[model samples]
Target: MDLRVLEYFLMAAEEGSITHASELLHVSQPTVSRQLIELEKELGKTLFTRTHKNVSLTQEGLLFRETAREILALYQKAMRENTGAETLAGDIYLGMGETGSVVFLMEQIAVFRERHPGVHFHLISENADRICEDIEKGLLDVGFIMRKANPLTFEILEMGLRETWGLLVPEGHPLENATSVTGKQLRREKLILPENSFFQSELLRYLGAGAQERVGATYNLIYNAFPLAKASRELIVCLGYPGERQGGLIFIPFANGKDAYASLIWKKRPVQNPALAAFLEHIGHTVSE
Candidate 1:
């Protein structure tokens, strides 16, 4: 339960050896072992599987590792924001889905950093749903999402950028040479699509009845699905950006398809963090100009 013990546990997990962890921590080997043992007892779970030479996480340890990281990150963020009271210095955690609008956001960040050099930015790339969840949990200060934000829970800033939806076709595939594809045409092909339920519903509505039957797989991120798409010769239904060129793959737009608009969102709450406040102000000014 102690943060120090959590640190010791993480160190041992990373190094896979108690001696190595102790060496890194500048603590005695037995001290590190004791702390880990105490941690396991406190949690009432065996965290690590021991071997003669190395250690590895048990199934429970694997899950708890994620929780431990989040706890530490939140603690670190709080400490940074509270300590630097005299200076405009703190961390701004931002989550974003993969989109070309990120280019615009990065440009704004560059400008913001130039004005407040002491402030730091942490960028996390994830799907829109995950990003929104983190913002709601106070883990992320802001997020760039490809879907509309619920006005009841979030303040939204439209980026004025729209991404076209399309299919990623492998070379020599039947649809590779097509200029544009239709939903009716897509229904005939085995498709890989985005994993978000809201997005899936929209696509399914466009594809009409029985379209769900043709879905081969769903992916949280598009890049991870590219290999499977190529090997299986399945079309990937994804957002298309300008100047996008993938070797051995072709991006063909959906004829008359609805575009995905980008939006920057944050939880509707009083601005407490100075860095986040400045960032929101800068974004508002940038958008207005």
Candidate 2:
């Protein structure tokens, strides 16, 4: 029931003998046996079968062994991060709005891991709103979102030095040749759109006000843009990204450059986790260069 008991049970299972488990745990053999018995009693199942010569796990024991391992792994990671080992090793739960910036993050993470082997990451990708909400709830320690998002609940770590958002297009699309197009040209085609955020509403307002009509097809997120556009080579998706240089689709820069504003968000307080701090530093460096 207690974590300490689970630790003892897991150690006993791993070492395969009370004597060895006690030696590794730096406790007496009887202490190890007593704790293991207490653990089995609490679980209401036999964790091991022991004899004069050998010890082995029962069916329940095997299952518990894996669960114990997972629990211990998480605990160890948390303790290390909380204790400042995060400078050299820790885990970070990060969220980002899907963008080509992920490739950039990956590159920096690879370098960070090589330099400091102790740090690990569990990264999630989502649209900007959810990223902010998760950070507020502590599900994420740090996040990335469109720079113009309301940041009353979070802190902006960096701003306005990211890549341009471009159009997602199919081959042979007419606008492919154009470097930038007006809101008038965009409304004439099927455009992929984001949800009802300030980003989307503001862009639509500018496009419609500029051209006096709707601009392209509407969708919830940039990823949704791909599916709608894929069906028709004639359909073009207007999205924000460091869009592909050249490919199945065209990357048309936004004329007003409205799509380029995105920022990194996190709780307004200093992050207590060392791994997160280091990771944030690495990302900041990557953003700068």
Give the per-residue Cα lDDT of candidate 1 at 71.
Answer: 66
- Residues 98-159 of candidate 1 have per-residue lDDT tens digits of 66678889999999999899889999988888888877765677899889979999999988
RMSD from true fold, candidate 1: 5.8
- Considering only N, C-alpha and C atoms within 3 Å, which residue pairs clash in candidate 2? 89-118, 89-119, 147-262, 165-241, 169-249, 191-216, 191-217
Q: Which residue segments of model 2 deviate by more than 4 Å?
A: 1-87, 149-151, 209-224, 233-247, 284-289
Candidate 1: residue pairs that collide: none
Model 2 score (lDDT) = 0.67
Worst 10 residues of 2 by lDDT: 234-243
Maximum-TM-score candidate: 1
What is the lDDT of every predicted structure here?
Answer: 0.82, 0.67
* Top candidate by lDDT: 1
